[model samples]
Target: MKFLEKKVKSMEPIFAKGGKLEKLHYVYDGLATFLFTPATTTKRGAHIRDGVDLKRTMFIVVMALVPALLFGMYNTGHWHMVAESGNMDLPYLNDFGAKLLYGLIKVLPMVVVSYAVGLGVEFIFCTIKGHPIHEGFLVSGMLIPLVMPVEVPLWMVAVATIFAVVIGKEVFGGTGMNILNVALTARAFLFFAYPTSMSGDKVWMGGQEADGFSGATFLGDAASLVSDSPTVDGATGLMDKFSAMDSFIGIIPGSIGETSVIACLIGAVILIATGVGSLRVMLSFALGGLGMGYLFNLIGPGLGNEYMQIPAYMHLLVGGFAFGAIFMATDPVTAAQTATGKIWYGVFGGMLAVMIRVLNPAYPEGVMLAILFMNVMAPLIDHYVVQVNINRRLKRLKTA
Candidate 1:
C-alpha cells in the first residue's frame, strides 16, 4: 500500500502544475482521488466528517443492484428461448448454463453501451470544465440499462445516455444538482421519442413469439384488456398465463432488471440497512400501490374496464412498480428529505403509478412517470413539512 501510494505521489509532480500534462490535471486528479481518499482536508471551520464517501456509497448501491442484474440476465435468456420455442411450459432454472450464457450475450452489450456513452459524456463535460468527474454516473450508468427492454438498439441506448448526461443531468450543473433521476431521464427520452421500439411484445424478447405465447409484458397485456374477461386470447387467462409465484420470482418477461420482486427487495434491504435509502418512501410507496389496486379491484369487472380487477399484490409485483419503489422513488437527491415528507412523496408516487397503469391505455408502465412527477413535487413536500414544524415550535414558544 505504501509503495503504491509512493508511486502515485511520485508521478503526481509531472501533472502538478507546470508539467507537460498539466492541461489534463482534472483527469489525473479525478483518477487519483477515486483510487484513494483526498489527502487534503479542511484546516478550519466546523464540519461533519463521515466514514464513507460518494464513491463508496455508489459502490454499495451498485452491489445492491447486482442480484437484479444477474436475475434479469438469466430471465432474458430464458424468455427468449421460450418465445422462440413457443413453449410456455418450459422448465425454469432449466439448462442453467445455456440460459445464463444467452442472457449475458444479450444484456452485456447494453450495459457496455450504457456506460461507454454516459461516461464518455461525463468525461467530455468534466474535461471542458477543467473539473474532476463526479461519481454520480457510477450508479446511473448501471441503472439506465436495467430499466430498458432487452432488444432496444445499442444506438438508441447511446443516444438516450447522451441525452441523459447532457440534457437530463449536466445541463442542470451535474450529478447532485439534477432534478430528475438520470437513468429514468434516459428511459423517458427513449419512451417519448421512439415509442414503437420500446413498446409491443417484440421488444421484451429478442426473437419472435410463438403462436400461443406472446412476449408482451404482463402490464402490456393487462392494459389491452377491454371486456370483463381475464383471458387475453381465449386460452389461459391473465392470471393463469402468469402465476403469482412467477411474477414474484420474475420468470415472466419485462424490463431487464425490474422483473424480479425478490431482487428488488434484496436491493431495498441493502439500501435501508446501509442508510443510503429511506424506508418511509419504499414502504409508503408499496402501500399506495396496493391501496390503489385494491380500490380498482373493489370496482369489480364492469363498465368495460377489466384491467381494474388485477389483484392488489399483482400491481406491486408486475411492471416496474417494485423496482421504482425501491430504487427510483428512493433517490436521495430527488426524494423528499423530511421524514414525514418522504411518506407523502412515496404514497402519491405509488398511487399515481398504479393509477396511470390502470387508467391509461396508451402507456402500460407508469412507474417512470410516477417517480418523475414526484421528483418535481419532492421539494414542495419538504417545504411544507419544514413549515409545519416551524409553526408548531413557534406556537409552543408563544404559549410558554
Candidate 2:
C-alpha cells in the first residue's frame, strides 16, 4: 500500500499545472484521492477537522445502498422470469444464480449508462473550470438506476443523467449547492417528460414484453378500484390482493430498488448506524406519512375514494416512501441543514407524499415529487429555525 501510494504521488507531478498531462489533472486527482487519504492538513487555522472526507462519506452511502441494490437485481430478474412464465404463483427461474444473472443483464447496463453520462459531464465541467470533480454524483449515479423503470430506454437514462448533473447540480454551483436531490431530479425529469414510460404497472415489471402477469402497483390498484367501485367490498378486495408481508419482503412490482421494505430498512440501518443519515428525518418523514394515511383512512372508502382504505403501514412500505426517506431525503447536500429544520422538512415531505399519492391518482408515487418539493423549501425551513434560535439568544443576552 505504501509503494502504491508513493507511485501515485510520483505521478502527481506529471498531472500538475504546466505538466504535459496537466489537462487530465482532475482524473488523476480523483483516482489518487480514492486510493489514499489526503496528506495535506491545515497547519494553522480555526477550521474544524475530521478524519472522514467527502469521498469516505460518499463511499459509506454507496455501501449502505448495496443491500437494496442486490435485492433489486434479484427482484428484477424474478419479475422478468415471472413475466416469461406467466405465473405469479409459480416461482420462475427457481435458481438464485439464474435470477441474479437475469437481473444483472437488465440492470447493469443502466448503471453503466448512468455513471458514464453523469461522470462525463462532471469531467467536462471540471476541466473547463479547472476545478476538481465533486464526489456528490457518486451516490446519484447509483440512485438514478434504482428508481427507474426496468424497461426504460437507455437513451432516456442518458438524457436524464445529463439533465440531472447539469441542471440539478452544476447550475446550482454543484454538489452541496444544489437545491434538489440529483437522482430524484433525473427521475422527475423522466416522470414529467416521458410520463408514459416512467409510470404505470406495465413499465414496472422487467419482462412485460413477454406476456405474463401484468398488474398495477398497489397504489395503482387502489386508484383503479376507486374508479371502478365505491363499495367497501371493493376496497377490502383490493387490499386483499396485496399482503403486507409481501410488500415488506418486496415481492410486489415497483421500481428497481423501492419495492422491498426489508431491503430499504437494511440500508436505513447501515446509513443511520454509520451516522451518514439522519434519524430525525427518517422518523419524522415516516410519521408524516402515517399521519396522512390515517387521516385518509378516517374518511373511509366511499364515493370512489378507495385509496383511503390502504392502511398507514402499507403506505410506508410500498412505493418509494421508505427508500426516499432513508436515502434521498436524508441527503446532507439537499436536505434541511438546521437540526430543527430537518424535522419540519421531513414531516412536510412525508405528509405531502401521502397526500399526493392519495389525492392525485394521476401520480401514484408521490415520494419523488414530495422530496423535490421539500428540497426547494429546505432553505426556508432552516431560515425560520435559525431565526428562532437567534431571537432566543438575543433575549438571553438582554437578561444577562
Candidate 3:
C-alpha cells in the first residue's frame, strides 16, 4: 500500500499545470483523491473539517446497499427460473448456489454497465469542465442498477446512464446541484421513453419469454385489484399470494433490488448506524405511507376492491416503497436539510408514493415519482420550516 501511495504521488507532477497530461489533471486528481484522501487542505478562512468526506459518505451508502444487491441477485435467479419453467417448483429449484450463480450472471452486467457508462460520463464531464470528478456517481451508479428491471438491455442502461448524467445531473451543474436523484431520473427516462422494457409483465424477469408464468410483479397484481380483474393464478386470492410474510421475506417478483423488506431494513440499519442516513426522514416517510395505506383500507371496502383494502403495513412491504424510503428518500443532496424539514420531506414522500400506487392503477410503482416530487418541494418545505422557527423566536422576543 505504501509503495502504491508513493507511485501515485510520483505521478502527480506529470498531470500538473505544464506537464504532458496537464489537460487531464482533474481526472487524475479525482482518481487519486478517491484512492487516498486529498493531501491538500484549507489554508484560508475558518472551516469546520471532518474526516467523513464525500467519498466516505458515498462509500458507506454503497456498503449499506450491499444486502439489497445480494438479495436482488438471488431473487432475480429465483424469478428467472420460475419464468423459464413456468412454474413455482421450489423443490427442483432448491439449489441455492445455482440460483445465486444465475442471478449473478444476470445482474452483474447491469451493475458493470451502469458504472462503466455513468462514471465514463462523469469522467468526460470532469475533463471538459476542468473540475475534479464528483463522488456522487459512486452511489448513483449502484442505485441505477438496483431500480432497474433484470432484463433491461445493456444498451438501454448505457443510454439511461448517459441521459441521467447529462440531463438529470450535469445540466443542473452536477451532483449536489441537481434537483432530482440521478438514479431515479435514469429509471424515469426509461419508464417514459421505453415503457415496454421498463414495465409490463415481460420486463421483470430474465429470458426471452416468461413461458407460462404470469410474470407480473406484486405491484402489478395489486394494482389489478382496483380494476375488478383479480387474478388467481396460484389458486390463491391477491391477498393470499402476497401474504405479509412472503413480502417481508421478498421472494416475490419485482425490480432488481426492491423485493425484500428485510434487505431494505438491513440497509436502513447500516445507513442509520453510520449517521449517513437521516432517521427522521426514514421514520416519517414510513409513517406517512402507513397512514395513507390505512386510510385506503378503511374506504376501499366501500369501493368493493381488494387493492384498496390492502392493509397499511402492506404498502411498506411491497414494491420499491421500502427501498426508496430507506435509500432514495434519505438522499442528503435531494432531501430536506433542516432537522425538522427531514420529517416533513419523508412524510410527504411516503404519502404521495402510496397515493400514486393505489389511485393510479396504470402506474404500479410510485416511489420513484414520489421522491422526485418531494425533491422539487424540499426547498419549499424547508423555507416554511425556517420561517416558522423565526416567527416563534420573534414572538418570544416580543413577550420579553
Candidate 4:
C-alpha cells in the first residue's frame, strides 16, 4: 500500500502544479475518468453506487466474444480444408490444429489492421480535440473483423475502418454519443462499397485458386431459394439443400464468426452469466426471429409461393443472426437500457431482420441491418418505457 501511495504521490506533483502542462495533464486525467470511471467513495446522503465501470463492462463484452472467436478460427480452417479436399464430412478432431492455424493466419491480420487504423484515427481526434482518448474502440475494433468475410482485402478493411471511425463515431462526437455501432458502420461501408467482395456466392470461402473452392452460405442458399430457379434438384427437400445440422454447427460459409450457432450461443451464455449483457433482449430477439420465420412458413403456401417456407430454426442459425444477437444487438451503449425497452428493441430488430432476409431478394444477410435499425430506435423505446414508469409514480402519488 505504501509503494502504491508513493507511486501515486510521485505522479501527483505533475498534475498538482498549475501550468499549461498541468492543465493538459488534468484534461488527460479527466478524459480518463470519462472513459473509465473509478469506483470511489460516495458522499453518503443518498448516493447510489455500483462496482462496475465502462472498462469493466467492455471487458465483459470482450470475454463474451471469445467463444465466437475460437469457433470462427476453427470454422475458417474447417471450410478452407473442405473446399480444398472436397470433403465436407471430415470431423473437427481429425485436423484441428492445422485448421486453427490457417484461420489464425487469415483472421489475425484483419484484427491488427482494424485496431491500428481505427485507434490511430481515434487518437488523432482526441489529441486534436485536446481530450483524452475514449477506449470504446478497443471493443469495436475486435468486433469489426469478426463480422467481416475472411477474404476481405486488407486495404478494404483499412478504408472501412477509417470511414466507420470518422463518420460513424467521430461525426457523432465519439463513443457514447454515436448513433450507430461503429463496427457495424464499418461493415455497412464494406457491404455497399464493395458488394462483390462483401457478398455473393464465392466470397466467404478463403484459399488460393489451387484450392478449387466454391462457397455456399446458409443465407446464400436462402437467397437462392428466392429465385425462380429451384435451389436444389426438384427431388431434394429444403433440408437437403442446406442441412439444419450444418447451420447449427457452422460448417457452411458466411461471415467469419457468424457461421457457428453453437459458438454464438456459448458466447451469449457467458455474456448473460457475467451480468454484462441483457438475457431478456437476446431471448426476445431469438423468439421474435423464430416467430417471423414460422409465420412466413405458414403463409408461403397461401401466398402461392414455395420460397417462403424456410424453417424458423434456419433463420436462427443462418447468416449473421446468431452473431448479431450475441454481439451487435446487445451493445449496451447503442441498445435499450431498461429491461422492458430491451425486449421491444430486440424483438423489433429480430423480426425486421427476418422480414428483410425473407422478403428482399437483394440482400442475403439481414442481421446487420436489423441491429442498425434497433440501435436507432433504442432511445425511442426507452423513452416510452420511462414515461410509463413516470405515469405509474404519479398514480401512486395521487393514491397516497
Candidate 5:
C-alpha cells in the first residue's frame, strides 16, 4: 500500500508555482473570486483585490434574464395564435402546444441570427485584438429578439444584428467599450430603417397577412389619434379607440416579448433574487415612469378636446418600458455601478422614455432610445460617484 501511494504521488503532474495552471484556476473560479478579493487594488496605498471577473458578473445578468426569455417565448406564440384565429376577444389561446411551438418558430430565428452574427463579429474582433472573447453578447443577443416585433423580417433581423455588432459594438473596440447596449442598437436600427415594419399594430401579431390584419398598437393608436384628430375625416378618442385592458394584460399589439407585463414582473423577481440586477434601479425606473405617466394623463386631458392623454397604467404596460427597465437599463456593464448612481440612471432612463413616448408624436416606443442614452451617461455618473467617494476619503484622512 505504501509503495502504491508513493507511485501515485510520483505520477501526479508537477505544476509550477503561481504558473499557468494557477492563473487558469483563478480565472475560472467564478463567483468565489468576488467574495475573496477586495474590489480595489492599490500598489503603495490601500491595495485590495477581488476575484470577481467581468465574466462572472455578466453571467449573473444572463441568469436573471432567463425568466423573461422563457416568458417571452410563450407570449410570442400566444399572440400569433390569437392573431391567426382573429380572436381578439380571448386573453390567451387554449392550445398551449401550438402557441408555444409557433412562438418558438417565430422568435428562434431572430435569437439564432443575433447570436450567430453578433458573436461571429465578437470572435473575429477578439482574435484580432488578441484578447479572450467577452460574453456580453450572451445577454444582448437574447435581448434583441425580446424587444423586436414578432413579424419583423428575418433578413432585417440579420442585417440589424450585423449593423449593431459592427457599428455599435466592434467600432468601439468590442465589449466593455461600446457606448450603447448592442441589442438596443439593433432594435433602434430596425426601428428607423423600417418604420412601417417595426411600428404598426399588425407587426406584433404574426401571420397578419394571412389573417387580413388591421392591428394597431397602443402607442400607434395614440399617435394616429393625435395626428388625425377631429380635423381629419374620421378620428376617435385614443382610449375609446383601443382596449386598455388588452394593453395592460399584453393581449394588445406591440413588440413580441414586451407585451406581457406579468411575465416581465416575474422575470424581474428572478433577476432580483439571483442578485444579478439592481432592485434600486428597477424600482426607481418604474416609479419615474408611473409618475410621469400620471402627470401626463392629468395634464393632457385638461389641455383641449383633440389633445387627449393615455392612462398612467397604460404607459407601464405598453411598449418596452417593463422589458427595458427589467433587462436593458439594469445592465451592469453599461449602467451606473454605484448604488446612488443606479437611482439617477434608472430615473433618468424612465423619464426620457416617457418623455419621448408622450411628447414625440413621430416615434412610439422610447425605451430603446432611453436605455441607449443612459448607457452613454453611465460612465459619467460613475465618475462623479467615484469623485464623491474620493472627496469623502480625503476629508476623513484630514480629520484623522
Candidate 6:
C-alpha cells in the first residue's frame, strides 16, 4: 500500500503545472488523491477542517446503502426464480447463497452499465472542462440500478445514465449545483420515456415469462383495488397473502431496493449516526406521509375506494416511501439547506407522495415525483426560512 502511495507521489510532478502531463492534471490528481490523502491544504483561512473529505463522505453513504443493495439482489433473484418456476412457495429458493448468486447475475450488469456510462460521461466533461472529477457519481451510479426494475434493458439503462449525467448533473454546472437527484433523474427520464418498460406488472420481476406468474407489486395491487370497497379487514387480508413480513424484509417483487423498509431503516440509522443525512427531512417526510395516509383512511370507508382504506402505517412499509424518505429525500444538495426549511420540505414532500399514491391511480409509487418536486421547492423553502429569521432579528433590533 505504501509502495503504491509513494509511486503516485513520485509521478506528481509530471501532472503538476509546467509538467509534461499537466494537461491531464485533473485526472492524475483525482486518481492520486482518491488513493492517498491530498498533500494540499489551506495555508491561511478560517476553515474548520475535518478528516471526512468529499470522497470519504460519499464512501460512507455508499456503505450505508450496502444493506439495501444486498437485500435487493437476493429479492431480485428470488422473484425471477419464482417467476420462472411458477411456484411462490418453493422452499429451495430460500437459501441465502443461491439467492445471492441469482441476484448478483441479474443486478451486476446493470450496476456495471450504470457506472461505465455515467463515469464515462463524467470523465469526458471533466477532461474537457479541466475540472476535477467529482465523487457525486459514486453514489448516483449505485443508486440508479438500485431504484430501477430488474428487467429494464441494458441499453435503456445506458441511455438513462447518459441523460442523467448530462441533463441532470452537468447542465446545472455539475454535482453539488444540481437541483434534482441525479439518480432519480435517470429513473424519471426512463419512466417518462419508456413507460411500458419502466412501469406495469410484467417489467418488474426479471424472468423469461412462465405460466401463472404475476409480477404486480403491492402498490400496483392497491391501485387496482381503488374502485372496490376495501375494508381494513379486507386490506389486511389481501396484504397478509402478499406477506407483509416479506415486504419489510424486502423479499417482495418491486424495484431492486425499494421493497424493504427494514433495509432502508438500517440505512437511515447509519446515515443519522454518521451525521451525513438530515434527521429533520426524514422525520418530517415520514410524518407527512403518515398524516396523509391517516386522512385517506378517515375518508376511505365512506368512499368505495379500497386504496383509501389502506392503513397509514402500511404507507411506510410499502413501495418506495421508506427508501425515498431515508435516501432520496434526504439528499443534502437538492434538499432544503436551512434546518427549518428541511422540515417543511420533508413535510410537503411526504404529503404530496401519499396524496399522489392514493388519488392518482396512474402513479402507484409517488416517492420519486415527490422528492423531485420538493427538490425544486427546496430553495424557495430555505429562502422563506431565512427571511423569517431576518424579520425576527429586525423586529428585535426595532424593539431594542
lDDT of each: 0.85, 0.85, 0.85, 0.78, 0.71, 0.85
> Clashing residue pairs, candidate 2?
none
What does the lDDT read for residue 360 in candidate 5? Answer: 72
Residue-wise C-alpha lDDT for candidate 5, range 284-350, written one tens digit per residue: 8888887887776566654443323666666787888988898888876678878899998898888
Pairs in steric clash, model 4: none
- How much does each candidate deviate from the true structure in C-alpha RMSD? 3.1, 2.7, 3.1, 4.5, 7.2, 2.5
Over all chains combined, what TM-score does candidate 4 have?
0.85
lDDT (tens digit, per residue) of candidate 2 on 68-173: 8899999888877777777777563377898899889999999999999998999889888887788888899999999998889999999999999999989988
Q: What is the lDDT of residue 72 in candidate 5?
A: 66
Model 6 lDDT per residue over 75-132, tens place:
8877777788878786634677887898899899999999999988887888899988
lDDT of 4 by residue, 307-377 (tens): 46666777897888988987888887788888899999989899999998878767857889989989999
Per-model TM-score versus the true fold: 0.93, 0.93, 0.94, 0.85, 0.78, 0.94
Looking at candidate 6, the ten consecutive residues that score lowest on lDDT are 41-50
Estimate the lDDT of model 1: 0.85
Model 2, CA-based lDDT: 0.85
**Cα deviation of 160, candidate 2, in Å:** 0.5
Overall local distance difference test of candidate 5: 0.71
RMSD of 4: 4.5
